[model samples]
Target: MGWFGDDSDEAEAYKQVMQRPQELSRWSNQLLGDAAAYEAGKAYEDHVAANGHPDEHHQAKEILAGVIGDFVDREVEVQGLDFIDRDWAKRHAQRRAEIELYDQHGDRW
Candidate 1:
């Protein structure tokens, strides 16, 4: 069984993809254990939004990956570039509010 469109591999592929329900359920339960964790905090989001520019995290990741520089050395390496000209915080908050409402109303979010 291999990944070369072999019929013999179909069962393996099926099992691989379908085998994660238990793990997914366990992970979901663990994640949802604290209801507040899913509650995205505004101050935290704002902080990330503010400090996420010029992506120090990305730079660190690239540095770890052995890209030698204080930053990623490429034109395509722009970070924290948001195309939307509006305050994403409000939009994000609204989406979260909807999800929270769904969760509160006994519907899965």
Candidate 2:
């Protein structure tokens, strides 16, 4: 078994992490519609362009905190794994941010 438990549990955890972006995107799209979503996405890109890409961990936490709320302690529990910590949050956020950036600018830059 892996650290989390059986392989199935690990897979479930991976699935949960992987689905975060879609969840966020759906939420944003429903709440703001396409035009606003595009604007929101551009904002993230602008932040990266102006301030440079955030440290992966910080970026994840920032996204999570923005989407949800401030993280208590250093971690937040999620599916499969014992908890979703800042590092995991960061990795997820980084992927989400990249997709958002791509959606906004495509291959233009």
Candidate 3:
């Protein structure tokens, strides 16, 4: 387990999100616009062409399309912009503790 009791895949994903708040904010802003729809369409076309099995490709495309649609439609607000604030400080402390744990054990847990 991580220092923050983050042993599951969901916890790990949340940790990654906490680590890249700025990047996530930027990407979320981009995804909120029409560019993401265009890119998702192109990516789906490319994936369909690259995959060999037609049935599998279609299923995968459906799943990918749903995910892209959800991301585009969802409202994303970037919080904790102030580094000196209590919330930001707490999150930074937790992330630092996780990093220290990783440095000590190197994912052995």
Candidate 4:
């Protein structure tokens, strides 16, 4: 009979050392980024309403999230983490974006 587990499972478990500090940092960054985006977006809209729309496009949430995402990647490397689940981080960012949008506008769209 084959063994009940494989090397991949054990290696993954060992690699994840529960980075509490980094997790806290990420949470703070996400919250701040969302708040900043919401405020900046409102200012942008107000400006556009008064001065007409500009030719350039402005997406505060996406831009802020992308900047934070880059920082997360760099942090993982600096923290010497064996494995960082970028996909997981990305999912959190998407969820936060949706929530912030709804909270700011009272609409899920």
Candidate 5:
């Protein structure tokens, strides 16, 4: 758990590595919930405004998450934080986007 490992396995000598989800957080900080998050939320809100809210808010959240996730991956690499897990970063970005959407739009979306 302390040391990190991808989804790989082999002989027992190396010891079975534990996949820690929490540790997957390489960018689950304000770096996500900050400016980029605002933009992502705004974009999703605009989408909802134009197309109307999805039948399920989770769908909108998923849309926001995907956009933020892409942004996170590109920005992390651009900022030279390649050690972070892209998927993990994306998941965190999604969470922030969902919160932002809720704060901005409330139950309307």
Candidate 6:
């Protein structure tokens, strides 16, 4: 029994959710961090500093927006979402990995 359905039922609904590759909020944060790091280069920093303190934040915002936009634009590249069932995806992934390991190397020898 699980979110998708009981043990007797297939987890098709759950699998659909798992197959999607949409980036989460954390991905945006990571993109922002990376953008900020790159924009922190001396030349960029100097240019912003010349403008004013507020301009620095503005520049960082623009850079982060662009980075996030790029990532969103490429969201379609995510695949394998509908292969199984979303609710069961995590358990399926774990079980598959375990089975793979067992197949590669017997559990007791």
What's the lDDT for all of these models? 0.28, 0.37, 0.38, 0.42, 0.52, 0.32
**Candidates' RMSD to native:** 19.1, 14.1, 15.1, 15.2, 14.0, 20.1
Q: Which ten residues in a row have the lowest lDDT in candidate 3?
A: 28-37
Between candidates 4 and 5, name the one with more favorable lDDT.
5
Model 5 gets an lDDT of 0.52
* TM per prediction: 0.20, 0.29, 0.27, 0.39, 0.55, 0.24
lDDT of 2 by residue, 1-109 (tens): 1112223322344334335544432322112222222233445555666887556645633643453222211113332223334444444444444455444444444
Cand. 2 Cα-lDDT: 0.37
> What are the per-residue Cα lDDT tens digits for candidate 4 across 57-91?
33434543565465456645666543556546545
- Backbone clashes, each candidate: 0, 1, 0, 0, 0, 8
Ranking according to TM-score, highest score first? 5, 4, 2, 3, 6, 1
What are the per-residue Cα lDDT tens digits for candidate 6 across 17-101?
2344264422332232222223222223354358643334344444334433433233323532233233243333333323322
Off by over 4 Å in 3: 1-33, 56-61, 66-109
Question: Considering TM-score, which of the candidate structures 4 and 6 is the better prediction for this target?
Answer: 4
User: lDDT tens string, model 1, 60-109?
Assistant: 22222222121112201232213222223234333443343334332321
- Model 6's lDDT to the true fold? 0.32
What are the clashing pairs of model 1?
Answer: none
lDDT accuracy of residue 105 in candidate 2: 41
RMSD of 6: 20.1
**lDDT score of residue 28 within candidate 4:** 40
Instruction: Give residue 100's lDDT in candidate 6 (0 to 100).
Output: 29
Residue 86 miss distance in model 6 (angstroms): 22
